[model samples]
Target: MITVIGTGTGAPLPPDAEAALAGAGLVVGARRHLAAAALPDTAARIVLGPLAPALDAIERFLEKLEPEKPDERRPVVVLASGDPGFFGIVRALAERFGSDRLTVHPGVSSVATAFARLGLTWDDAVVVSAHGRDLRTAVNVCRAHPKVAVLTGPGSGPAELGAALRSSERVLVVASALGSGEEGSDEEGAEGEGAGGERVERVTPAEAAARDWGPAVSVVLCLDEARVLSPVRTVAGPPPGPAQWALAEGDFTHRDSMITKFEVRALALARLGPRLGEHVWDVGAGSGSVAVECARLGAAVTAVEKTLDGVERVRANAAAHGVDVSVVHGAAPTVLSDLPDPDAVFIGGGGRELPAIVTACARRARRSVVVAMAALDRVPAVRGALVAAGLDCDGVLLQSSRLAPLPGDVTRLAATNPVFLLWGVRPPARSEGVAQ
Candidate 1:
């Protein structure tokens, strides 16, 4: 049997974990964890690096144990940081040996300690582990949500996170060396200095990216200071993805009745499939109604509009809906080069450059792209562009009529203009998951 103990996040080892370590005949942990513990002189130690090797070592140790006399066998303990079950070594161990043969003891997560240092409640915050994973999802989550805790690892550290968030107005709280008794300096008003070796510092994204914050960093909190304190949330994790989506035309601020109709917008949204930790692009964002709706659905959105007024309209609509949307004041196909690749894209208006814009968006979109057009002439070109970009193309013609109050106490079906909604989905093999 194996015992997994979570520690090193400024918490003392529980008595249960201590007792397990005392009897451990073989111990496995990171160098820091092993050095911090008092292991028996007879017990063997393995410094963990690449997990497979350590698992192999543990397997060898377990195989030598006499299965019939379980009580006579010395304990095998693996030490980990924070909650071992949370993006830690427990999963790997369980998969190799099975859960029935192991016991676990959890410690305070770095995310919880970081938030506590700032006197903030983390119930409304989204916690993402960027350790050994793509940083794009964490960046997009920080962009879309007000509060986020990122578990940093090597390349995905505070500096990298700060660089990605340079354009965004966010305060990064870098908490390092939690519970270590290291001396703290007053840089950036570092706090929590007393007996605990923790240093909590606040810096802007630019400031954070400017310096090197060694291996001591425990966690980074990316917060939109304006909305850092959210209302009491009954359900956690990204605010439950907006109660309703595909809002009505009257709900948004548009110009000259120039917005995607509710029916067309509905289908476009369905194809886009916006959700937390994903990025969506709305090209030719007229009035930004579609962009606003996508943002409301908890995806990081960038609304590109050529007209300055249109950009402002998109911003206003996003603000009105209490969502964050990066409004880019420029045309697509050219402006898209500066923006990050999106998981999904919605092209509403592109005029003569429609096919070019669709091609540009389709090539960069990781999952799917949806194009809405009124002119049948552009349909073939758009479809060709999607196909050339290696996307599986599909389309629909939406013709809907809404009930309108007419003459004398009666209602009539008002026919709306016909729209062609074309959607291109990347094959599963080519598609990227949000957590990637």
Candidate 2:
């Protein structure tokens, strides 16, 4: 049997884990874990680096156990940091050796510890790991949700996370050296200070990006201070997705029936596939209706509108919906240059420059580009642009009529203008750069 112990988050090992370690004949773990533990002098040890080799070493040790005397078999123990079962080595161990052969003792997780240090509850916060994955997903999550805990790794550390969120109005709480008893000052002092070797320092995203935080970082808390303390939730993880989407035109403050109709909005939302941990661009966001709807669905959205009234309208609509959308007040094709690349693009109101805007958006869109238009002439050019950008393009013409109340208290069909909806999806081979 193999024993797994989770420790190193400033907590003493439970008696069971300590007892397991004492009887271990072969111990395997990171160098820090090995150095911290009180292993028997006779115990053989392996310092973990690459995972496969460590598992191989453990397997070899287990194979050598004498089958004749099951009672005499010395235990093989693996040590990990802070709840190995949570995004840690437990899965790998369980996969290699059957789960039946392993006994796991979990410690307090860093996310739990970090929140404890701040004296805040974390059940409402979204926790994401950037280790061995793309930083953008974490960044996008940080953008969409008010509270998040990010597990740090080599390339996806505080500086990288901060760089991505520098423009956003988020506060980064860097928790370093957990359980080490290191001393740190509370510069912001908004939240209570870190108590132990865990030095929790709060800084703006820009400040975080500017500093070179070394490998000691355990986790980073990205918080929108305004909404940090949420209403007590019955369920966990990033507040469940909105109950409804494709809100009607009356729900938003739009000028003179300029909003995308509910039918088109519903189809556009389906093609866009906005979700948590994604970035979406809404070009020519006329009423910001699409932008607001996208934000409501949990994607980090940027709504670009050229006219001053349109910009104000978009912001107002977003505010009314209580969803956050970064409003860029400028025409598309040019303004899109300064924004980060998007997983999806929605074009709603590009007039004469429709084709150029579509080309610009298609080239940078990582997943799909969706264009909704009323003009038939612009379809060919937009299709050509999507094809040139190497996207597998498809389209549909939507014509719908809704029931209207007549003077006689009867219902009649009210025909809405037909709209052409085109969407271009990036081939799978070309869209593996980001993770959601």
Candidate 3:
């Protein structure tokens, strides 16, 4: 059996952890952890780096005890930071050794401690791990939400986070080497400021990126002052979805029927499946009604507009709704290449290059793509582009009408133009459990 223990950010092993180490025949951890653990003289220690070797060593130790009596085998302890199960080595260990053969003891996560030091509750904050991953998603989350926590690591540390968030208004509260036991929060305002041991301080993204913050940072809290605490609620984490979507055309500024109807936008949103951490492009964003609605639904959206007035309209609509919709003032097909690949794409206004835009979006979309067309002539080519991109193609034609009051008390149906909504989803990869 394998025992994975979380050594809190501070040193000095707890009683239970000490007991495990005292009897451990083999130990696997980083040099810092190994040096602080003061393991038994007889125990075999492997300084962790390039995880495969350490896991292999543990496997060898476990194999040697295969024929020994269960009671005769000494304990094996693997030390980790915070919760090993949370984006740590425990996953690799469990995958190699099986969950049934492993036991885990968790410590306070660095994110939790950072929030605690601020005397704030985090039930409303979205926590994202940027460790060894792109900062774009995290940056977008910070831009849209009021409060967020980013788990920092070598490549995705404060400097990188700061540079990406330079345009955003979030004040970064960088928590460095938190809970190091070597320093106390009360000793100074910013614990790790210059002491180089442990500290916490608030700085603008521009300042953070402009200078070196050293390498001791454990986590960074990106916060917008206006959204610190939500109106009293029972639930947590981004509240819930808006009560309504696919808002009325009058609710947004548009270029005279140039915007998609509420009925079509509703179906398109459902097909696009926009949600947190996903990027959706609203090409030819006229007044950006569809882009605004998608942003309101919590997806990171980039509104691509060819006209300067249309770009301003999208920005105004986004500001009016209290959401972020990055307005790219350029036409599609060409502009699509430089932008980050999207999880979903909404082709709202593809002009003469409609087919090429659809092809480009379909090629890069990670999840699905939705295209709307008022003209029947473009449907065939759009469908062809989607199907040729190895996606599952499906479509629908929607026509709706509302009752209008006339001179009398009686009412008459006002029919709207019919729109064709075409969409496709990427086929599941063969490596996944889904049948190919």
Model 2: per-residue lDDT, tens digit, 1-436?
Answer: 9998887776788898898899999999767678779999889999877789999999989899999999888899998777888888888999999999989998777788888988989989999988778889999889888899998777788889999998899999998767665421111111122234557899999999999876577889999889888898899887777889888789999888999999999999999999998999999999999998989998999999999999999989988988889899988788989999999999998889999999999999999999999999999999999999999999999999999999989999999999999999999873676776
Q: Measured by TM-score, how close is model 3 to the native structure?
A: 0.81
* Model 1 lDDT tens row, 324-407: 999999888899999989999999999999999999999999999999999999999999999999999999999999999978
As for candidate 3, its clashing pairs are 191-199, 192-198, 192-199
lDDT of 1 at 232: 88
Better of 1 and 3 by TM-score: 1
Question: What are the C-alpha RMSDs, in order, of all predicted structures?
Answer: 4.6, 4.7, 5.0
Per residue, candidate 3 scores C-alpha lDDT tens digits across 264-352 of 98899998988887788899898899888888888878889999998999999898988878888888899988787888999988778
Q: Which runs of model 2 end up more than 4 angstroms from their true locations?
A: 182-196, 430-436
What is the lDDT for 320 in model 1?
90
Would you give me the overall lDDT of model 3? 0.81
